[model samples]
Target: MNQTQQMNNDAVVEVLNASGASDIVLVCEHASAFIPTALNDLGLSAEARHSHAAWDPGAKAVACEMARQLDAPLVASKVSRLVYDCNRPPDAPSAMPERSEVFDIPGNKKLTRNDRETRVARYYTPFHDRLKQVLSTKPDPVVVTIHSFTPIYQGIQREVEVGILYDQDTRLADAMLEVETGTFVTRRNDPYGPADGVTHTLKEHALPQGRRNVMIEIRNDLIETADAQTSLAIQMSRWVADAVTQSKDISCRV
Candidate 1:
């Protein structure tokens, strides 16, 4: 395999490694450190939303560890979420963010259809296609997309340790509640809502199939450290394993 193929064949995105344990398939659409070379930082300062937009700072570590522990496959994006959010639909505003928090991305503003197509062809399409390909190989696997949120966003304090986001898959959500019950304090879609469409991966693939699926959001502050990442991965792995067991009755809608 060539370099690109080698990378793809090995790591899940540019970060996560596909697991070989459970039937669960994990996705981290924001796991990346890449800012497209053509955009040249998208006209923002090095510190301005770079870490957040480029990647979920600390999420990849936990995601990688989770893949390892669960022995499940993962499909993640190699490009920055700011370039084109893999979780969002092709037309969502955040799908091509002009302003993420404090930084204004000039390159993303007033995108032509061709420009949009370039990003889609380059990043978005490949990611989703890979996801579909992975799922096709697995049989009714529980889809779990991992993401991390800033501890504080736009001056708002987010207190939830984890957020279980889903539109319809109550099985995995209920299982998560049972696992983390009274312990870690998981919010049922507190930080963000599914209607926003920023997290469309679960919606597009997971929920439609009536598969046991949930997007787990860990506070970025909690998993930035290696020890914390490992701990969180182990905890999440147990819940995922439980959810997999519980999902035996889930009929695929695909």
Candidate 2:
């Protein structure tokens, strides 16, 4: 973590169901569209302020619901990705993307090294630090990160509704992909993959520790409505719970 500028006192992360005993920890990297008071909307247009470029539209809702259903602790970032992408490392260009899809982030444009380091310290560091803290509490942990992708990106239309993404360790991803996806066109690493740098959260938080981890991507269009979010969450809860159970059973038998 780079630290040229002093970090802010604002809370950059949220941990829900902190006391839950479940062996799972949920993470939502693009949970909020809240840019800090200092960034002035990250020089975003009125439309871009809350666009998919800023945050995953319904990721937090679904994550919260899944946390409730599974009685798991969720560590979610509270700031917009335009400020600093919590899932991305400071060195990654996408960590402070100047361009997202069709929107241009004027605030992130022409950033200096110090400026990038400051944002990393203020947003990225604390977010993952708290995540590490949350993970430290669990005896046996299964890391699950929640995200939502756009139905259309740039000029292409994406057909995959759910994506199970992973890096090196695919225990959870393998089991999760095996679970029934109902009507969702769930696939292994569709839309985005490890090559796309979408699995930084899994790589940083789960892989080195040898924990079972999977990143779940729900198509934003499917989770637009509150009811739709809840309905999808119910189905997702089953997928996750069943997968975790299967993993534990296999481990015990081994």
Candidate 3:
């Protein structure tokens, strides 16, 4: 097998099942520990590769617990986000990032069309295809893509405790913001929003159908540790359930 083929042989995509029929489908595009061995850690520092740029440290854990609480199915990526962020549009600058943290991605630095396609086929396409398959199986299911962001970017501290992002489905975002009042909640135009260059699988599929969806961003500091992850998961589960309840009421009227 070729290098990419060999890497693919051990991909670890995760799908957690809840007991009964579910009205929700959760996905964490950046949840993964998969780093190809051939590239030798992409020549990154231990800190850089382990940081948010490579993957969301506790996102999968939070997502899994939320899935259990909601009785929802979750589809998560198995490859490192550095391979290809499933949350980014194919042409997004960060989709195949050249540099993350202080390390230059030798593998991602310069690419021919074929090289890009190879990564896309191996990483991006599979992640998206799996998401599409899940949605197809359960049309109109509410899609929630979970992610975590750094508490500080560059040198600035972000005060917002949570950022709820949405494009077409403002209902959910608005609801989340309402619940988050007295707390720091921001309705980000693209704080998690989609710009022309970057958008996730949720935008491609959920926005078109006007399916109720939201991209939730919690600060990494709040979820990086096990205790923090569990706390945030429980908090998010309650709020998400409330949002779903509201959505059902609206759907019933329509």
Q: Would you estimate the TM-scores of all the predictions?
A: 0.89, 0.93, 0.87
Between candidates 2 and 3, the one scoring higher on TM-score is: 2
lDDT of each: 0.76, 0.88, 0.75
Model 3 lDDT tens row, 53-72: 78877888899889888888
True-vs-predicted CA distance for residue 65, candidate 1, Å: 0.3
The predicted structure with the larger TM-score, 1 or 3, is 1
Candidate 1, run of 10 with poorest lDDT: 8-17
Q: After superposition, how far is residue 120 of candidate 1 from its true place, in Å?
A: 0.9
lDDT of 3 at 113: 83
Worst 10 residues of 3 by lDDT: 245-254
**Per-residue alpha-carbon lDDT of model 2 for 174-249, expressed as tens digits?**
7887776566898898888999998898888887887888899999999999999999998899899998877764
- Winner by TM-score between candidate 2 and candidate 1: 2
Give candidate 2's error at residue 57 in angstroms: 0.3
After superposition, the stretches of candidate 3 with alpha carbons farther than 4 Å from their true spots are: 1-12, 18-20, 181-190, 196-198, 249-254
> Where in model 1 is the C-alpha error above 4 Å?
1-19, 250-254
